[model samples]
Target chain A: MEWLQNFLPLTFDRAVVWIGVLCTIAIYSLLYRENPFYRFFEHMYIGLAAGYSLGPLGVDILYRYWIEPIWVQGYWAWAFVVPFGLYLYFIYSERYGWVSRLVIGLLIGASAGLFFQEFSSRYLVQLNSTLQRPLWFSASNPDLTVGNLIQNYIFLAILLTVMTYFTFSYQQKGTVKGIATAGRWFLMIGLGAIFGNTVMARMALLIGRAYYILSDWLLIRVGG
Target chain B: MQPQTIWQKMLAVDRRLLYVLLLVNIVMFLLVPVRMPASISPPVQKFYDTIEALQPGDLVMISSNWSASTLAENQPQLEAVIKHLMRKKARFSIISIEAQSRDISYRLAERVTKAEGYEYGRDWVHFGFVPNLTVAIKGMVTDLPNTIKQDVRGTRVSQIEMLKGVNSLRQYKLVIDVTPSGTVPIWISYSPKEVNIIYCPTSVMAAEAYTYLDSGQIKGMVTGAKGAQEYEQLLGIVGLASRFTNAISFSHVLIITFILLGNVAMFMNRLAERREA
Candidate 1:
């Protein structure tokens, strides 16, 4: 018993790392073949993630916004906010499903209101930037060099072609079709670039796991 | 059945073998002591310059909204950004929309700050997790104190020594959204126009952000671990990104090789079938 105890992690931090190692190995086991170890850890991870969220939700959100205001701050009006939100669950009740719409309507109305600002803030800035690009270098825009001028021309060309591709007003024929095809090719190239970045990101994640195993568990110095 | 051709055998290779090869490649490269130099992209350089321009004690809001799922990409980005901020002697406050991020970022920042002798309340603070980004940004824009009533430690935001006079997001010098999510749009939509916004998006999210970068909506960007590596080069310190650079770069080469090998095998298999026909 003493020997077994000595072999086990005696400290809390060490125990945590031990569990982390076990979980990591169990999760990665699925790469070889589906097995019970992977399934067990997978389910445990989902359950733990959901349960862990409640801790922060209670302390940071529910307690701070809902409970504290009603109980401590005497903002009694804030008390009904949760129950009003819970009205959304009425959708499950055949008789009271209409009650759910009240919450849904509030959400829709709020989202619609938010969209006004969102559209103006998000898209308008980009539009302004597109329109503001100087196609040719000038004295007034001395900072816009030969490289920037060429970039702006390429950007505008792609922008128009892509927009033209999505134009559903009429059937694209001859030159319009040719431009649209070019747009499609450009989009494919963009998507390829994105996929390339995705591969890089996935590799980084694998490297991270390997680093953990080497540096944390095996006590090997990684990356010198 | 007749003996299978080499091309057919290559085509029928188990996917598990590919995974093992990738794992081996990453592990081998991770152990390699050689540090590769990164070519700094314009966006990464701009990201560095934005922080370097920050005067001492200038307030910045860090929207750290990434969890352990994106730890490999976002962790190094956040670490490098935090180190840069601390170097500039900036007083920053972090807000997390992701629940796990609140704890992860807070713990990470604490560990980083501890080594640098950075004080918690006066020098930096974590406002903890807020459920919604859109509503939170709008609230912080109008009333920072009332919106974020308390820090993660339960101290009132108004009573915090550093935030005594800060009541609106407009007062902050900069907003840095360190995320793997699309929450930057909300910040762009609602944040004070005076404050410069920057981004640290995971590589997958980086492609879509170019339009914003072009628009100058975000003053700068750091796109994932590779970007972080370039940033570390600029900062002249060997951090996690610097350490992980060799592995990530080499892994890309490995994947490209795999792709080319698969394509060649397929082409050769097709040509053999044509000859047999």
Candidate 2:
């Protein structure tokens, strides 16, 4: 082991990088064919990620929020917080599963309350912006140029068509059916754009790993 | 009795071979000395301007919630944003909703700030990881010190010099959410109305955010590595994003080419089968 370390860049940082490179290779081996090496690394990666999160959970959350207050600040009531949270695990009990609903209900109530503010803050502004769009050239908002006006009209068309497609209350007529078809086409285009971006994002991840191997591990200077 | 048709052969090309070809293409682009400039998108331009408008000593909250899986995109965005904040002499703190991000962002910030002489407690801090951002943001909006309680190092939030007078989330001027997750809506919904938000999402998450950007809920955005590359250009510094941009651009080209070829092969194979019939 000592000789192995000596033969390679054996410093702690370098060693970690080497291990990471090996892990990367092991993980990528699955692309060729599923093998034990890939499976071992795959499990190891998941396990390591789970284990690593415990450090922050303990130090940042459990210790800072729970333990320190109880021990140093003499806040005895803080101790009950964890036990109360543990009631969620009561869901596993066949006999007392109803007890877990208390926690779930509390969470749902809190989330529902929070969602009111979320709805107003997140969607209202968008609604306002949509309504405030300058359909034609206006003196009040001089910056709303010709191009913006055209774009706004296009936006309105798409919004109306898409909304019509989702309107299930009435039987769509001939014109309505055409608009709904156009809406579906628009949605497909939007989805294709999303798929394109997704491909780019996935490629970036692969490129990142390759860059790590070539530049970090091999000490190859890539890109000026 | 006869040689295989070109379309049949093309259709039958091994997926492993395609993977190897893609790997080679990426490696070649990564190693190539050439650099392709990025056209600054509206979102990236807005993102740059939003940060550039920040005055010195103004507090900024960075919600770094990306793990190692997105290091390629998020790392460059964070690095560029941090450097920009430091250059402006802004007081900033990072909070991570993801546990892994807490350490990764902290270490990355430490490395970046150490070179720029930004002090830990006085100039910047890491609030560590919180289990939930919605709860944390709401709590911090009401009582920042009581909610976060302490920094990652166990130092009380009150003791941290940068947060000396900061009592609520309203005191912060900007919130930069660097994430591959959908936590931006929570920040927008729950955080104080005064604090403007900017987003840095992975490319896949960027499309959904356009509506938010259009509405001014988020002041700006940087979408993945390509966005980062544009941001680096605006900053006038060649960083990891700039380095990765060529490979990123070429990989898209490779994928698109393959898709077109596949379609052509399919069409030709169908035509040949019709002729045989």
Model 2: how far is B109 from its true place, Å?
0.4
Clashing residue pairs in candidate 2 are none
Q: Share of real interface contacts recovered by each model?
A: 0.79, 0.86
Candidate 1 C-alpha lDDT tens digits along B1-277: 4439887888788999998888888888888999989999999989999999999999999999999888999999999889999999999999999999999999999999999999999999999999999899899888999999989999999889989899899999999999999988889998888999999999999999988898999999999999999998999988888989888988888888889988999999899989999
Report per-candidate TM-score of chain A alone.
0.93, 0.93
lDDT tens readout by residue for model 2, B149-222: 99988899999999998999999999999999999998989988989999999999999999999999999999
Note the residue pairs that clash in candidate 1.
none
Model 1's CAPRI class is high
lDDT of 1 by residue, A1-224 (tens): 76556346777876877788899889999988999999999999999889999999999999999899999999999989999999999999999999999999999999999999999999998889888999876788978878888898899889988888899899999999999998888899999999988887887887887888787766678897
- Candidate 1 runs further than 4 Å off: A1-8, B1-3
User: Could you give the DockQ of candidate 1?
Assistant: 0.80
Q: Candidate 2: which stretches are off by over 4 Å?
A: A1-7, B1-3
